[model samples]
Target: EEEEEEEEEEEEEEEEEEEEEEEEEEEEEEEEEEEEEEEEEEEEEEEEEGEEEEEEEEEEEEEEEEEEEEECLEYINFCYKLVISVCCERSVVVVPHKDTSGVTRHVMRGEKCWCCASQRHFRCHTTCHARSLQP
Candidate 1:
């Protein structure tokens, strides 16, 4: 009877040890699963951040392009306005004066004045008569 009791106690101890080991293995598996989930979440967050940054960079580039286009248009309009100068005779268009000295047949920036023009053209007159053959 004493031998039988000792054998039964030894068998119970072995079963308890096996149960503990199984529980430990289950806990380890849970921890591994949790860690894997966290890593996956981190990867997703990184991808989202990268996409957002790219979108922001593209928006900034577009805005810069729009600003450049607007500036170019304004510059073109201003230059055109300067090119059409008002002559002295019939004053309609007003523009800044730039002297192109001794330039006949080609009027630049409005008036063909005394110093710059030939003898026939009056001050501020749009009409320019061709040079006479006589001296």
Candidate 2:
């Protein structure tokens, strides 16, 4: 009878140890699942932030392009005005004038005097006279 009681006790102890081991394994699995979920959440947040930054960069680039286009339009308009005032009006001249210090200044002065007058002088004069109804 004593021997039978000793064997029973040993079986009970073994069963208890197995149950404890199973509970420990389940806890470890739950911890691993929680860690994986947290990692996934972090990755999603990072992706969203990166996308926002890219959108902002694209907006800035578009604004810069628009500003450059406006500047180019202004330059073209200025050139048109210069051509009209200098090439069409025949007001360009290379003359001598006295400056504020009584020094003689011989300067080629006009709206577009930087252009080659020798090549366009005849055409300009004819066009100007025709447009003005002059003889």
Candidate 3:
């Protein structure tokens, strides 16, 4: 009877050890799952931040384009006024003349002249004269 009791006690101890090991494995698995979840959440937040930054950059680019368009319209109006003043009121000759400076002073046949010359008045005068001849 004593021997049987000793065997039973040994078996109980073995079972307890197995149960403890299983609990430890379950805890480890839970910890790993929690860590994976945290990592995923961090990645999602980063993606959202990147998207917001991209949106802001796009908005800024759009605003810059609008400002450039407005400036272009204003320049066109100024050029139109110059054409009217020199062609109609001044009645200057619509010919290209090169002055002391090497820069050519007239609009090309098919090309637009930005009036890039050292002398502003002469440049506007020639550009306006050329513009008058256009249909």
Candidate 4:
């Protein structure tokens, strides 16, 4: 009977050691899973931020294109009007004027000559001098 009691005690000790090892393995697995979940969340947030930045860049480009288109249209309209006036023999003159109020960059003055009517932004003094000189 003494020998039997000793064997039983030894078996109980072995079982307790195996249970402790299994508990340790389970704890390690839980920690690994938590780490993986946190990493995934971080990756998702980074992707979302990248997408937002791209969208903003695209919007800015589109707005710039729109502004360019409007400016081109305005320039075209001015050119068309100039052509009509020239064809009708209506003289147009462009004279440089200082902006007293910081508003207009240049102001027109006097009736435009035939040469000025044909040329765009024609300087009257230079062209007049060239044309009027004895050839």
Each model's C-alpha lDDT? 0.57, 0.59, 0.63, 0.58
Each candidate structure's TM-score, on Cα atoms with residue i matched to residue i, is 0.63, 0.64, 0.64, 0.57
Clashes by residue pair, model 4: none
Task: Put down candidate 3 lDDT per residue, 1-135, tens digits, no spaces.
Answer: 999999999999999999999999999999999999999999999999999999999999999999987865665565566555555554542344333353536543323434343334443444444443321
The number of the candidate with the highest lDDT is: 3
Residue 51 CA error for candidate 3 (Å)? 1.3
Worst 10 residues of 1 by lDDT: 126-135
lDDT for each residue of candidate 4 in 1-135, tens digit (9 for 90 to 100): 999999999999999999999999999999999999999999999999999999999999999999987865665455444444443463553333222343423323343433345443444333342332221
RMSD of each: 11.5, 10.5, 7.9, 9.2
Expressed as tens digits, the lDDT of each residue in 52-82 for candidate 1 is 9999999999999999878656644553443
Clashing pairs in 1: 88-124, 89-124
The local distance difference test score of model 3 is 0.63
TM-score of 4: 0.57
| Clash totals for all candidate models | 2, 0, 0, 0
Poorest 10 consecutive residues by lDDT, candidate 4 = 126-135
